[model samples]
Target: MKEDSVLKKLSRDWRVVLMVALVIFSVIAIGPHFDENGQFATNLQYGLDLQEGSWLQMEFQAEVVTVQTGQPLQEIAANLSEQLDAEVLPVGPDQIEVRMPMTEAELRPLFEQAGAEVVAVNQGVSKETAESVKRVLDEKVNSLGTKDARVNVLTGLNGITRYVRVELAGVDMETANEIVGKQGKFEIRVETTGDQTQHVLFGDSITSVSTPEKDPHYGKWGVSFTIDEAGAKAFQEAAISSNAVNDPQNHELIMYLDNETVYSAPLTVELANSLKANPVRSLTATTGTGDEGLEKAMNLEIHLRAGSLPVDVKVVGSGSVSAALGDYFKILSFLAAVLALIVVGVVIYYRYREPSIVLPMVMTTLAEILILLGIARFIQQLDLASIAGIIAVMGTGIDQLVVITDEVLHEGRVPSPSVYLKRLGRALGIIMVAASTTIIAMLPLALMDLSTLRGFAIITILGVFVGVLITRPAYGKIIMAILSK
Candidate 1:
């Protein structure tokens, strides 16, 4: 009857119920199952160490500099671009991101000539440009239909990105090289006589490309883009020479990306007439109405840039892992995790010499791991370092649980309910302070762009929180119930 009452009491306790519910939810999230090939699988994602993959770390061939100019920042960027014969993007009120690697000495003269003072120079691109490069790489990877890929921009404390890392799972080194190196060649050509076409401009001439937007007037989907002055002149000349402006239907304008025809349509009557008058810098390539058109328009927007990154990049480091090696690492990582749990359980059992107390500690620690993994499944991919972190968390979790056990069992006698509550509160207070210290120490690693240690730091911090907030508190309650009897 006492045991039944204890069970009923724990069931009613919100902390115990929450812990049980979270464990069930975590199991579902992990979803341990077997594939058609009889291989075990789960929703958890593994990093390069446990997967056959290639990783490339590329450095952007760009420089971020602080410039102080009496002229407007945008105008300084434009003038610097023209003077240096490279792309210059404005980053801040006094910062210009030059898309070419130039040293301080090489840039000082140019800045002086442009009526701007070079305040400071750094060897990287702005965060925005880094993100743009990442976006382009993501598009390229998606186009190739890679199953799993990750692109990360490694920024520094100064808020400049010097390197970007690419990881592609189940891909060989050579193929990975090709994928990152390949860039689409986008061309605009006008049909002259029957099928013969004359080139008007290349993707380099494109100044800006916009997202697919529905035309308010016609309800058609289109991508609006702007070209430079030179490109506008070339486009107009091609239209006139090809007689496209006169015979808009027969003389069609075709857009090609990597030699594959993407958009082929005659010049619109209005556009043809306008081109006959003068060069038009702004143009819109319209697709037909509805879902298909919207999809095509989105694709057209991607092709318009021709896979051009805002700044060039050079591969600084690269590595590949074979399937056999990855499998070996995976096995070792699994064994390490299991060994950690076993060692922790044995140590706890030895310390308490009581199954009731030791079992709850081990079980509570396991619950913390499950909850961490469940949350990680959706947010972070586990790597070898992450496994190490899990082990570390297991150790820390046991330490905290032991603290609770020792505090509750002070003087080797069952305390009254009021005393138990006070002890539990004191134990939790210690755990919270320890957890705070761990979190504070790990904050830099978690927030900084250190790709390798990020997973480890994040998982450790999460485990600390789970222990302090959920599992440890519930364990205290359950142990009190058992001791009270």
Candidate 2:
């Protein structure tokens, strides 16, 4: 058969054979389902936003004595840390400290309130005990498979008492409470000491949250509001009758963060409409319990409740890789490539009289492109440098393929096809010189800090490499056969 004879002639070239082999090899390297943790093995790295983790803020009870021992500062810190079994950061030489979350169960409730004393906290670490908390944090980091993260410790002062602060960056809301600044559980039964027992309630009942303009003249960050409709009327009555006692101390609505009076101020503004009409001019609204008793309504049982904080964060720095830019870069690279191809194609066509001789190398150039992209997606971040490398590799492939085309098909220079191999040797020498110069030119980008530009340079150097070494020879072998045809 005439077709069988032509196919048999083409089959003699090993280039076609090797190209098929590399394709099969690449498929095996990146195919199939991967486990969650095993996804790391697939060479697709995710950014921090893509990863799931947590941010935490723990607050400690201000005035609490755990042990009866009247020990010195160092002894107290050591004993406290030992009790919690986590990291304990002390505020000063005298008082105040913190307990970072170390375990899932470190914040569970333990006991219930009794006849006006207080309840006990259950199976969780307290500032009284927790020494190896830092180790737990380290283990958590290692499990994430990332080296990038942020941590900070701070102290808050009020001219009266100092409070401890801790901050960990780049975490989602859900995981934050685990690293609570304290064992954020307080259950105190009250009798108001020698005078009248202070109103003790949960901090979890803040019906509304807002930054209100309490005083336009005193420009400062502040939040003000009235309770829900039902609670508002009751709070109004309590403030009206108690308005005469106006002694700042007794009239003060003491606010606490886990049982510490962070704020204690006298009832000032009186909302009269709140008492009669459930004023919907309501600065804000919150769903409230039906309790209309003055004490019960005003006792806003609330806790900061591991709520989201007001810490402002912004993406001040970022690197974006636009596919549009990629396409434009690709087009630019393509133009340069097309220009290079035209120069080589012109020289080769002038030299090789047969069109059949030039066609196979053109096909080989396309194959080079597939191989370059496949490798880039496998090994490194597919950035601009990789694109540059791909373009460079494509150009070299065509250039060398042109060389093979000329040497093997030029009827004026050769009588036997065997002599054509010698021309390939000289062509390879020329490729080496060109590739070396390109690689040297790309070296500066590798050392530079331009995040966007580095990827381009990296790809360029690698492309020149593959072109000079493996691809050139493979292409040379294939086109050598195509030219012989």
**Model 1 error, position 57 (Å):** 0.9
**Which residue pairs show collisions in model 1?**
none
For all candidates, the clash counts are 0, 35
- lDDT of each residue in 1-485, candidate 2, tens digit only: 65565567556656556665665565454443567777423333222222333333333233222222234545555554566543333333433333342222332211011011112222223232221232223333433443433332222222221122222334444344343322343221222224443443343323433322223454332334434454544444444454422333445554554455434444333433343334322332122233332222222222222122211121222223333443555456548667766675566567665666555565566555555545665554543345455566666667666665555556654335556677778778877887788888879776553234666677677666656656667766655554344
| Per-residue accuracy of model 1 over 129-235 as CA lDDT, tens digit each | 78767878888898779867889898887888899999988899999999998888899999999779999999989987765789888999999998999999999
Q: Give the TM-score comparing model 2 with the true structure, all chains together.
A: 0.38
- How far residue 231's Cα lies from its native spot in candidate 1, in Å, is 5.8
Q: Choose the strongest candidate by lDDT.
A: 1
lDDT (C-alpha, whole model) for all candidates: 0.89, 0.44
Q: Estimated TM-score per prediction?
A: 0.81, 0.38
Off by over 4 Å in 2: 1-16, 27-316, 319-354, 409-414, 447-451
Model 1 has how many clashing residue pairs? 0
- Judge candidate 1 at residue 478 and give its lDDT: 94
